[model samples]
Target: MSLDTAALVTKLTEILGPSGIIAETAAMGAYLNEPRKRFHVPALAVVLPKSVAEVQALARFAFENGTPLIPQGGNTGLVGAQVPLKGNEVIVSLARLNGLREINADAGHMTVEAGMILEEAHKIAEAEGAMFPLWIASQGSARIGGVLSSNAGGVNVLAYGNARELCLGVEAVLADGRLYNGLNALKKDNTGYDLKDLLIGAEGTLGIITAATLKLFPLPAGYETAIVNLSSPEKALELFYAMRERAGTRLNAFELVPWIGLDIQTRHGMLDKDPTAGPSPWYALVEVSQPKGAEGGLLQAGLEAAFEANLIDNAVVAESLADRTRMWAFREQMSECQSREGASIKHDVSVPIAAIPRLIAEGSAAAQALVAGIRPVPFGHMGDGNIHFNFSPPVGADDKAFMAGAEPMHDAVYEVVLKLGGSVSAEHGIGQLKTELLKRVKDPVALEMMRAIKQALDPKDILNPGKMLS
Candidate 1:
């Protein structure tokens, strides 16, 4: 039997104290309004826990009472993972636990509480003359817990890897308020079943991550940034291979942007000046980092080779920090600029690195065929095969009507993605939004394993109950 709403609020307040609970619906806006603004369900209450012990207590209370708990941090997720799926669930925000526990700049690792903001983590690393290279647009407000939960991939993933790769170990709170003390910086540990891996991308369905040991690296001397103009995705792929062959791990980022992105940014006056070399069908924002005492001009030499190989036509290498900032501003503004045009149907999917060109060409064609004149705005980390395959509705199209037809458009685009052996959900894990899609595309055996693991970890089904396994 479900507890009365007032009773649930009272119980949570008793557990967390008055300052820790937000039971009023009107004041719950900040926690419920996620980045995408797609999920707006009212939660029973938003609970803020100050420490791991508090989180464990709340978890135990929720488990015993059969109250669903939604683990959240910063609320900056693109998917609906950080927000409430069922109105009866209680949200456990980990913002109050932001604190860095340990740092070993020479040993190349740091221990930080999950609620530390991503930007703050970067600052802590820089203070020690080290670096933690996860660069996403939401880093300013995105917390460490959500970043690890979603296994976020950003621009620098080409060199350092995603959150899962960057993380060494984690300290989490299990369903029955059991504390999991797994934090360590050991480079090698052939221990049992890798619980860290299991919890990293589980989307809060298994446990609440409290603290984590993240891998750090020596700070690079500087970065060589360039924006190259390409005729198509195929040529961009060629240029990418060329850069990877030359720079190897030094090639930090190779992002693909469409001509429509440029058009929209220019129309809205989002950039002070054009960042690309000239008008082209496509562009690649390629970057390479120069380590301490390493040779400079590596990116220029690589670009020169690409020009000779007929892979690139024109390029603009950043001569100053301001120039690099403007170029990145153009690439980062791709998502926000889409809203200015009108409604956009989006898919964050990934294919093999080599199959990226085909995925874009075929996916664009499929989306266009579905909604005639649909502006295809497919772009993103081409180096990693993940593309934000989004479509801007045709000119003068009603936003609601266009959105209403989104289901068919998504089906058409996903068909192409799966045919190319790509993933339907790449960096963003399945929250409430893609549970049905996960059911249809995921392998049956894999789904069964996921369900088994979910059951093993959370038997009472009180943790994000309807999400990911919907």
Candidate 2:
């Protein structure tokens, strides 16, 4: 039998005291409003658990009473993973659990609670003369738990890796309030099943991550940054190959941005000044990290080789820190600038590195064929094959009507992505938004295994019910 709403709130209050519960619907705006503003279902109550013991107690209550629980972090996710899917679930906000547990900079690892903001983690690492290189646009608001749950891949993923690779181990709360203490800093352990890997990208469907041990690296001496002009994605791919061959692991980032991004940002007065080498069809923000006691001419030499090979036409290298920051500001502001234009249909998809040119070409053509004059703004981490394929509605078009026809647009783009052997959801995991899509595209046996794992870990389905597997 389902628990009564009032009774559920009362039990939650008992477990966390009155201050830990937010029963009023009006005051739960921040928890309900995700980054995308897509999901709007009301939750039973928003509970702020201050520590692991509180989380375990709440989990036990949910399991016993058959109450659905949603584990939420900073609420900065693009997909609807961090928000409510059904109306009866209670939101468990982990903000109060933010704390640094331990740090061993020389050992190249640190243990931190999941509620810690990603930027705060970076600060802690820097204080010890080490670095945690995972960086995203929302790092200031995105928490470590959500970051690992989604297996977030950011701009620096080319050099370091995603959340899964950056994480060494995790400590999570199971469905029956059992604590799974998997936290460790070992570099190599050929033990039994890799529970750490299983939980890192599970999207909170299996367990609620309470704490994690993250990998750290030596701090770089400095960085070389530049923006190179290209004719198309084809030429950009060629330039990427040459740079990879030359810089190898030092090539920290190679991001592709279309001319539309530059046009949109400058038109909206988002940039203080233009940070490009005049106008071009496309631009790439290339960066190389210089390690301690190392020279810093790697990027310049690579760009020079590209010019010699006829892969690039024009380029502007950053001469100072301010120049580099302005260059990055242009790339980081891509998503916001699109909103300023109008309603846009977005897809976070990835193809093989070599197939990116074809994916962009075919995907753009497919979307344009469906909707006349629709503006295509496809750009992202070219080095990693993830292109944030997006489309702004045609100028002077009705926003609501354009959004109403989003289904067909999504189909058109996804078809091209799958044909090129690409993923429908790349860095962004399938939350409530893509459960149906996952059903259609994912392999049958793989889905079976995933469901089996979910059932084994959370048979009662009280932890993040109706998510991922649907």
Candidate 3:
């Protein structure tokens, strides 16, 4: 039998004390308000579980009562996975479970509780002469569980890889209140079906990630960074291949930015000074890591070669740490800078690496055809083939009307992406936002496999219900 709302709240409070439960609406804002502010469904209560045992207990209770449980960490997700969909679900937050279980510098691995913030993990790694390569813009507020759950990919994915690649193993609590202890430091295991992989990007539908063993690497001596001018995405691609051949694995990042990004930032006075060398249709931010015994200037040499080949127009190499930071700030602030322009329609999609140029070209034309004066701002990880294809409404257009027309704009861009053999979601996984799209776009057999896994792991559909799967 289903319990009444009052009984459920009272039982949750009884199990986790008054401090652990957030029952008041005003106090629940921190948990309810996700990063995008798109999902506004109110949760029944927010439960702060401080330990693995607490998490297991909470899971068991929710499973037995047939109440939906949304596993949340940091609440910094762009997708609505960490927030409630149905109004009656309870949010089980892992923030209070923050703990650093162990760090082995020699072994190059750190076992950390899921609640630890991503930036804090970086600090711990730095202290040990190691580096954790997974980076996102919201690292300060994003926790390890949410990062691993979403399989986040940041700018450095060109060199290191995404969260799935960085994680060695994970420990999670299953829907039936059973703990799946899979954490280990092993680099290679030819064993079974890779359950850790399943839970890592499952978005909490299969299990609640409690802790993880993450791979680490020796800290680079420094970075050779530069921002180069490119006439088009095709030129950027040529330059990327040249740098890859020269730097090999040292090529850390290759990010593409359109001129509109520079214009918006400068017009809004968001930057102290222009970070680019001069005017160009597009800019490519490139970086190569220098090991302890290795020399720098690899980026400069590559850029010089590109210029000689007529692939790039000009470049500005960062001479000091401050210059490097400022150049990175310009790239990292792309998403936030769009807000100053007006209402924006954004899509995170990826094509084959070679098809990036075509994807951008075709996508831009389609979006422009739909809205006469729309400004296409296609930018992001060119090396990884992922583009943050965004469009700013015409100058002085009504925000309401422009936003109301977002559906056609989205359809236009997605159609192009689909034609290019690209994903509807590149880095950001499907939350409630794209569940329907996933059903329509994903392969039928693949969808069946996903459904079977969801049923086997979470039969009652109590964990993060209506997330990755519709």
Candidate 4:
């Protein structure tokens, strides 16, 4: 436990071999850097474990030596969960553990190693005539481990559910290097407790997840995508409920986007053309999936009903694959487009589906009141109520000054969200950035139970220290 820096690196190198160990700070840039570029503390070392056994060994070593180990995947997490918090922590990278263990398309499940890229998992499932429907922006670089660990919620969460719901079971290495092989694809099990759910969203605080059994769905025949023009969030909510009543699970995504987002993207040349039907106050990018041999045009039918009821102003249903891609491009490029304007204050908060309108309205009003003209760009999965309530700086405003008001902006939005019975950290885990906020907002008994669980699972506090629960 008292080993010096050289001795620590040498010990890790011996366990993982030289090529697997990143001993120097300069070479650890990829693992050190995160999506938001927020937390930048240097690590003692970065150890890449090639196999589950190697992961167990590394965990055992870190546990016995009392070395703070940060469990990292693709390092694509927006929060600081996948990166280091304390300078003395060593990053245990699962990059080398990339492998697909098993696939059973007939049973609607597949077992994949933690290090497998989410996009690759998608491709693998597609090759077998199935689909893993968790579609996040970072799927290209985000690995399975980090996706499950962070309990990622993406566009398709309205239907297929989040990473936790898509996941059947997890195979992990506990703090004491005990391999908990609970990977199963069963639909029903009256087990003692749901440990898979626990470790999946623990953000590596409970254990180091090595592999997982993920649920798969039959490939949809086609996806009907439409960008509907909305006058306000209230209309969008009404439209969402109507679609849900009609399509039910086929209604996959209901995303809300502000017209200013379109203006920002068009002004910045990020898009070739405006993807919406035309300019409106707000837009809802609604999509429904048609399964094989099932009826098509469900989304069209629903939209026609909405039109009859005078819900939306105008809309554009994607006619071809290219149109679909372009429509999605407009929605996916929201976060990037905001950066093109200036500094942006973002909150991944959620409200009740009914309360979404109030959350955006009051949150925007409160933000503008705190700092005049702070453009509110609240958008995301409206079906599930998780909105990325973000604010862009006004034209020609100072970035530093806008960011200086970030705390109050966050306070304002979270106040609205909490008042409406919503989660402050909707999809993103409480990493180093929101640890204090979680401490403040979370119930004391829940906090105590979480602390007790963390103590029971990771007694040494070596697994992802200073993350989630701090």
RMSD (CA, Å), candidate 2 to true, equals 0.8
Ranking by lDDT: 2, 1, 3, 4
Backbone clashes in model 1, listed as residue pairs = none
Candidate 1 lDDT by residue in tens digits, 132-187: 99999999999999999989998988898999999999999999999999999988
Between candidates 1 and 2, the lDDT winner: 2
For each candidate, give its TM-score against the true structure: 0.99, 0.99, 0.99, 0.99
TM-score of 1: 0.99
Candidate 2 lDDT by residue in tens digits, 287-340: 999999998899999999899989999999999999999999999999999999
Residues 136-245, candidate 3, lDDT per residue (tens digit)?
A: 89999999999999999998899999999999999999998999999999889989899899998888999999999999999999999999999999999999999999
RMSD of each: 0.8, 0.8, 0.9, 0.8
Score residue 311 of candidate 4 by CA lDDT: 96
Worst 10 residues of 1 by lDDT: 1-10
Better of 2 and 3 by lDDT: 2
- By lDDT, the best candidate is 2
Scored against the true structure, residue 42 in model 4 reaches a CA lDDT of: 95
